[model samples]
Target: MPDYKAPLRDMRFLIDHVFDFHGHYAGLGATDASPDMVGAILEEGAKFCENVLSPLNRSGDEEGCHFDNGVVTTPKGFKEAFAQYVEGGWHGVAADPAYGGQGLPSSLGLVLSEMIGSSNTSWGMYPGLTHGAMSAIHAHGSQAQKDTYLTKLTAGQWTGTMCLTEAHCGTDLGIIKTRAVPQANGSYALTGSKIFISAGEHDMSENIIHLVLAKLPDAPAGTKGISLFIVPKFLPESGERNGVSCGSIEHKMGIKASATCVLNFDGAEGYLIGEANKGLNCMFTMMNHARLGTGMQGLCNGEASFQGAVKYANDRLQMRSLTGPKAPDKAADPIIVHPDVRRMLLTMKAFNEGNRALAYFTAQLLDTAHLSADPDQRQEAEDLLAFLTPICKAFMTETGLEVTNHGMQVFGGHGFIREWGMEQLVRDCRIAPIYEGTNGIQALDLLGRKVLGSQGKLLRGFTKIVHKFCAANAEHPQLKVQVAKLNQLNQQWGELTAKVGMAAMKNPDEVGAAALDYLMYSGYIILGYLWLRMALVAQAQIDNGSGDPDYARGKLATCEFYFKRLLPRTATHRAAVEAGSECLMSLPAELFAL
Candidate 1:
């Protein structure tokens, strides 16, 4: 059977050492998130994932979800599995206490998300969408809306989804045909068909709260006219079916167990969540939450693939090592003995660790953005999150797909087969880059909006942090090389952004041309800084003395591998970014087709 074990040790390393959640929570005055409490939470969360969720992953995929007569039934074990999850009090780990939650730090919620995602991504989605909905309602919903919707969502008695896409529009929400008419009783009659709604219609919850985006009559044109609505599957007051119904679910390439529904709202009763004509703005609250979660999915998949690859490499014997057979008793050495195999393993490892640092750091910033008392700190954190979210969404998932591919490659032919389970990881990871706004869109957001829109202030927010870290650790005896390399990249990031900005002014297409490469280049540098931070923590642990030698040594070695092997990829991206748009746009649109 396919298997997964939570990387509790590494998570603890980040929580206890690198980001120092103990200190972070203490600073936030989050007394409930004490180290022991957090540790217990991680331990319990790990058990739920490893024991409860992991066992269902392969079974869920093989069986998938069944759609019949406008009804969706999850794989046999899913309902039960989700029940255990809800019973564990995990549904509201980070939600507000007033609404049946544990009232822990939001970062802890992300920690559980990573675990659940790695264990069973499809299963994870059932409750995952609820988080984004809860955030949207909390941030924008009125007290009545909060009491009616948030209470049930936080308690896991109800689930939620975001209904945005339609037949004609996916990313272009302005062209969506969904319409809402204001009624005498204050509710709106919502009529539209929304496609690709994950967890939109499911049997796991008593009710499903859909946050729908539609246009009001006489509303302005395009995305600006869009208005947000809360359309529940069961009316909160009447307890009767609302207009929302499951038209059908898509036959997908992967994540099949998660219902991707075609929801038809035929005069469905919905209450406006935010001001009319400002739905897009309100929807961003949910989109951003989901975007970050999607990015974590990338990391989770890479981590899952890496775990499989490591186990397979250590057990699967192939050819002799260049130096000689390390396993002399066997016919040939384990694949781990080969340098090429080691390269792949290290690549996955470096990215897994580096991305975890980035995610955790971003999570810390999220806590500050949401909870910090200091306005400046909150704004700085929010500004940095705006810059990091797209990078997290795009770069992590792209690399995640690469890692899954490599994991399967490690198994050679066996990886392609269903029995070993490596291929499923690849298939499941493919959607992350496509959904949550395509990576291309993410790049555009980074270069066109976040980076350029702010006149480079947003980019400066993160780069300045890297600059400060480099300055503080410049003279370190053990990390001088990494610190130097980081400083060089740190300096170059600003210069490259400036160059792209100048080129974009001369030709706006230059931004589009350079966006993908720029995002990747930024990702590498960001990971480089994260790796440096991790190396410092690992080095401190080693110097502090007395612990598992392999864990500490492994951390240092992987940091070195990232600097030597992976960090240099930024050069290629930098060259691509500097190449401008002339070569890219010179060809006519019709000429290439023939």
Candidate 2:
């Protein structure tokens, strides 16, 4: 099998050395949280994933999800695996403490999420969607709703899903045909058919709470008219009948074990989540969280792929070295001795470590936004979080797919086979860029709404943080070059932001065409910052002689590889973004017609 070990030491290095998790949590009044406690929790989470979940990954993928007679059956071991997961209290890691959660920092939650996703992504989706649904309800639901659902969801007794897409509409919600009618009891009668609903139906939970998006009879046309509703599989009170039922589940390309259902809601009993005719706004609250989670899935899969490739490289002996056969006693030499193979391995290592640092920093910003005492600090945190969300989701996943692909390449023929598991990593990581709003959509949101729409204020604020870090660490020998390179990239991104913003004013299509490129550029610069931060931390550890020299040396070497090899991609993206909208728009609608 696959030997999957949690990188707990590296995780601690990022938390304590790079981002200062203890100071962050202490500032938030979470004085009870000690490094020992965090370490124990992560160890337990690692064991749960390795011992309980990882063993089921291949079986779940081969069996996939099954649907018959309007009931969905998960892959054989899934139900039992999920049951064990809940019993371990893994579900409440980041939930509110008042509702039976451990209320751990989101930073810790990020590590757990990465572990679970790496172990089995399809299995990760069930609770992942549940967390997103719970976030939506917690933000907009009434006291009664919270009392009824929050505890159950936090405890994993009940699961949740967001039912947004229909057969006709996936990204554009303006044309959705799902309908809702106000009832006499203040609830609504919802009627719609939703497709691509993950975790829609399963035997793992007692009930499934669906947060549905639909339109009212007299509601305004397009997106503004949309409304969100809480429609459960069974009634909340008596566990009686509800109008919602599963028609079937989709047979997908990957993440096969996670049930994707086609749900039919015929006059389903429903209650409004927030104000009527404002569902899109409420759904975004959940979508933002879901999008981030999807990004984490990408990072997690990349990490898994790297581990698998490294193991294979160390064990798989093939060609002899060009200079001499170091293992003349053996059949051949290890593939890792090849320079090209080493390049691929180094690429995976650098991207995975950089992405991990990025994810953790984003998680820290999220915590600070909610927990920081100063209003100015909170606002700054929120702005940075909002600005980085798209980067984290789009850039991380895009690079993640690249890293996994390289990992597969390192495995040679074995990587292509399903039995070896590397192929599954590629297939599973592919979806992160497509779902949770395609990377293209994420780019548009970043350029049109977050970056240029605000006249580049948010982007500027973010760069200022990088500038401060660079200034503070100017004397650090290892980080100086990387910091300078990042500064140059940031300057170029700022200029590109202005040029694109001005061109977008002439025609909105310009924004649509260049959004993906801009997102990639931004992602590279942000990762550069993460590399610099990690390098600084590793240098400190080495100077103080506080940890193993090899580990610290490995960290510095990865940072060097990132700066030398991967950071150059920013130039290509900058050029693409600067090419303007003509390349994409020049293709006429009739060009493809025969």
Candidate 3:
């Protein structure tokens, strides 16, 4: 396996230039994240990820987690590394200062997360789920709940997990069998089984705080009956063991170091977090956070794989250059000289950098949504976040899977072998699209719920921003052509929505039929707009003679590659969207496999 190096230069380019993160932080009144402070954090974060976390990635995967009796133990060094993370305050960089956190901007935490994820995805999962659990409690938990759980969670004395899935249900929370009964005391007794619970019973934290969903006896039917609860492994005040216990931990394809356990809450004492019969609504608070973090996994694994593949491409000798001898001293030229190899490498590059741009841009909105005082600003940010979140989760993972495959292919036969560590990237990324509501479900949420449900209002929020950018840069000397192309797509995006809206009106199934394709199409356009924005910045830097010239030009070249090569994928998805449901529904269910 090749050593992982944090792409600090590129990360800085996005933070300092493309997104203007410094200005964003100041606007949010996060003066604590001064430019110098942000720089120091990123540098120190890189060292921790590189020296501490990265080394454990492969070894952790190989060792996996151990399940004994009812206790879940993480692989070697995971516990110590997590302790170091907490001691260094890395665990609560974005949590509220009231809860013993550093009180940094949320976006800054995401910036740090990219490195943590890229270096050791399995290890990152421990804190990753905890952050999601914290968000839910912060948004919906009672003041008492916050004082008790958030303080420990923020201080890293305890970790958290979101338990929504049961063996009988995944996305359909409506039919969950978990039950919560009220007690004479203010608490309830939760008796149910939750499966696929990451960090559910890990030994890395002193206590595991579980945010679980169940129903009261008199509650309404379906999803409306659900209620959220905080069930801990150990009673907070008395320090006695609760009824919650690990039934078993799953043996999975990848991320084996992270404990994915089946948790049985056997009359566990639980406290309600939010309004009764509104558990799904409360869970969304955590689910949305988890979805975004899951989307980052695509970028994380793709980056790790890309680093390995690119290194191998440069060092591994293969066929000679077609036209000439680029490296005559060697018996054969490096594989990177081949056009086919370049194609795979460029594809990986275009998707990784463009996806990074999209992720960072979304992080800015996250900050505005959370930190801004203005109701109108917060609402706009929220609207945009709702629209972009599904796309970010679906599109990025789909392309991320593609990127990792290409990375493996770049290594030829060596890629298939486990020693090179390229194949593990594929296995690790495989679950991303399937989990977090699956890419299919994410697509339905995007095209069906968010786009059509809003009557196109949500779609317009994002397109309006793209329209404004294109209008401002319509006549840029270096990027006018690219800007014009993005402008045309911006308009077409609205037209496509209107077309789908019309079809969905006539046949509701049209939304379901066209959803995945529509989402992929939307994703390409979104990436195109982001790539143009990045190119605009890079070109301006070149003209002004600021920053590294090669780096600036490299951005310009990647932007051009995206426009010419990958943007064409939109055409296929567009065609699929326009095809409607007739062809799909026309086939009878019984005829399949016949």
Cα-based lDDT for every prediction: 0.92, 0.88, 0.92
Error of 3 at 251 (Å): 1.1
In candidate 3, position 339 carries an lDDT of 90
Q: Can you tell me which runs of candidate 1 are displaced by over 4 Å?
A: none
RMSD of 3: 0.8
lDDT of 2 by residue, 1-594 (tens): 366788888888888788888888988877656778787888899999888888888889899988889888899989998888898888988888888888887777778988999899999999999999988988899899999999999999999999999999899999999999999999899998999999999889999999999999999999999999999999988889699999998878889999989999999999999999999999998998998899998788898899999989988999899989968889999999988988999988888888888889899988887677889999999898889898889988998999889988988888888889888888889999999899998999998999988889999998888888877876666577777777777777788888988888898888988899889888878888888878777788899998888998998898888888888988888888778888887889899695
> Candidate 1 overall Cα lDDT vs. reference?
0.92
Can you write out model 3's per-residue Cα lDDT over 82-167, one digit (the tens) per residue?
99999999998999999988889888899889999899998999899999999999999989889989999998889999999999
Where's the lowest-lDDT run of ten residues in candidate 3? Answer: 533-542
- RMSD in Å for model 2: 1.3
State the lDDT at 221 in candidate 3.
Answer: 92
Q: What is the TM-score of each candidate against the true structure?
A: 0.99, 0.98, 0.99
